[model samples]
Target: MTIHSISARRANRSAEARVADQGWRELASELNNHGCAVMEKLLSPEECAGIAALYPHEEHFRSHVHMARHGFGKGEYRYFRYPLPDLIGALRTALYPRLAEVANDWNERLGLAQRYPADHAAFLKQCHDNGQTRPTPLLLQYGPGDFNCLHQDLYGDLAFPLQVAILLSEPGRDFTGGEFVLTEQRPRMQSRAEVVPLTQGDAVVFAVHNRPVQGTKGHYRVNLRHGVSRLRSGMRHTVGIIFHDAK
Candidate 1:
């Protein structure tokens, strides 16, 4: 099917059904209460299989392996560097439309269209203002035994708080080692962290910065320092979608 068809189908999904399927309201409530929210089983098994099939293990091993700091200790971890093939196919065909819908929905929720219109306009203008620049999609893959360091997704002045990951592997079957962890606060006395063990078709939504609330002083903050734990079992696979350039 065409990308347009996929997007139309995704969009035609009733809001109530989407909420029921993804627990979107609960997630939104969690985000309101905290800085992040996790929704389980956001995608179907068939969709997960389709995404997984897009990335062959042999091909991934040949092209996307790399080393990065896995934890605070001396040792490093193996990571799949780029899984763009499947992601590109998904983006051009399926992901963007869903992402756009999410973006629009979130924009409405946060009233970002009114608050950050100038910033958004300026950013988009800057992207288009430059003659040689063309907006590009970023795709990063992770596999078993691989891990990423705790860091924010910020590059220069162009940064966005929202990000999405499409899970491609089965929870217990594919690989069991990589778990996405997020720190709630950093360098604070009462700081805490949470490890989100997500299954196929699940996604995590989080804020990159804290918005000030009336009663609390920095009580609700966005701690975007996130990383993955080492993969120990079967190989884990995921495709990340980001709007800004990966530096």
Candidate 2:
């Protein structure tokens, strides 16, 4: 789609529309069965390219992290500054309410008392009130030999439970073998690993730390972590939309 059309779509809240078309029932089912769900082509190639291009411009980001330097992994990423780009801001707002529904259900099933608000702005205000005022959305870049370590994206005590990452570069064409990976650690059971498939513009909405799993006895909390596998060749870029802020 052209930049003009993309702008028109965002202006008309197309993010919400497309997400609705994905069917909240089915999306929640997928999230409950697995720990993640893919929203196909949530962004256009042009839009992905535009966001990826912003990585080199430091003005758009507040902090840069070399993963290896922190013993996290081999890749690097930049945290977006306040006043996020138009598309990022729009998607964050549009996606939250739908995900919040699933999050609330999960919280109840897990016996957690925390409940998310119906609106993204209200939830964000709660985060800020708890001293998590810094933005958590980030852009990640990886090349050959680069990979992200298995970890959770918890920034503060006020975590939103779910987060999203949109692939900005095409597999095979733009890069290869840098797959999205998730691991589930259940009580007294063997851990399971899943490699999520994605193409350019695809977004995966996933659990950040914990999710409830149904057992014969009852619902139990399972630990979850996500990361990227090693890149074989070329380059990769992704934009992550994490709802909660950091200190």
Candidate 3:
């Protein structure tokens, strides 16, 4: 790509981000009340397709995992290499600061010792210093009957509390039956299941491992795991943004 092209794209992304930033306060409120929150059409359809099209490009990814082989489910995904795509990287950079505040608040509420840095770059540097240098952002693809198992994206010693997944394909048109699923486990309580609604270019910000929940006594920790249901028809593609790195 030409230097001018790159510069223009960056400018465009910055402009769009200014708009997204307006929703942060509301998003934070929703996340605190619910374990997850859906942001509508965070990316344009063309941008969504641009990301999905990268799934088959071997040069962009460092590693691929077959979910069935690892008992993770029936689909597959590939982790981005050191240099993520422009859009993916931009999304990560734009989303992190807002999320860090919520994460830190959760940490305080749960009395956790670790605190997130003010920005994504600083947090990533900490990960790198700890020998967790692998990029964790990934592209997932699923076809008929394919699904993802419930799990957290805790790759290394360090883990960010929040992560996001953007749906690249339109539901009902590009695929059906597969829904974003989040399960929360509360102490001595039955697991609660939530199927998040999403559309193409839409994204859901959710807890990576755990979140704080209010109880009669006080705030307590509740474990969270995310996955996808079976795809009844067509194919599905999603972009997962994980702020932390892997060992």
Candidate 1 is scored at a TM of: 0.62
Weakest ten-residue segment in model 3 by summed lDDT: 11-20
User: In angstroms, what RMSD does candidate 2 have relative to the true structure?
Assistant: 2.8
Ranking by lDDT, best first? 2, 3, 1
When 1 and 3 are scored with lDDT, the better candidate is 3
lDDT of each: 0.51, 0.93, 0.90
**Over all chains combined, what TM-score does candidate 3 have?**
0.95
Candidate 2 lDDT trough over 10 residues, lowest sum: 4-13
Instruction: Give the number of the best model, judged by lDDT.
Output: 2
On residues 1-247, what C-alpha lDDT tens digit does candidate 1 reach at each position?
9986665555445322543455555765666565567756655677667555545445433233344433342223222333334333333233333333444444555446522222333444543444313233332455555576666655436454555665667777777767777776544556567787788878666554432222344333334566677777666656555544433
User: Which of candidates 1 and 2 is the stronger one according to TM-score?
Assistant: 2
**Residue 77, candidate 1: how far off, in angstroms?**
13
Residue 28 in model 2: lDDT: 89
TM-score list, all predictions:
0.62, 0.95, 0.95
Clash number by candidate, in order:
5, 0, 0
* Candidate with more favorable, higher lDDT: 2 or 3: 2
Ranking by TM-score: 2, 3, 1
lDDT of 1 at 29: 60
Q: What lDDT tens digits, residue by residue, belong to model 2 across residues 2-113?
A: 9866785664486677667876787789899999999899888998999999999999999999999999899999999988887888789889999999999999998889
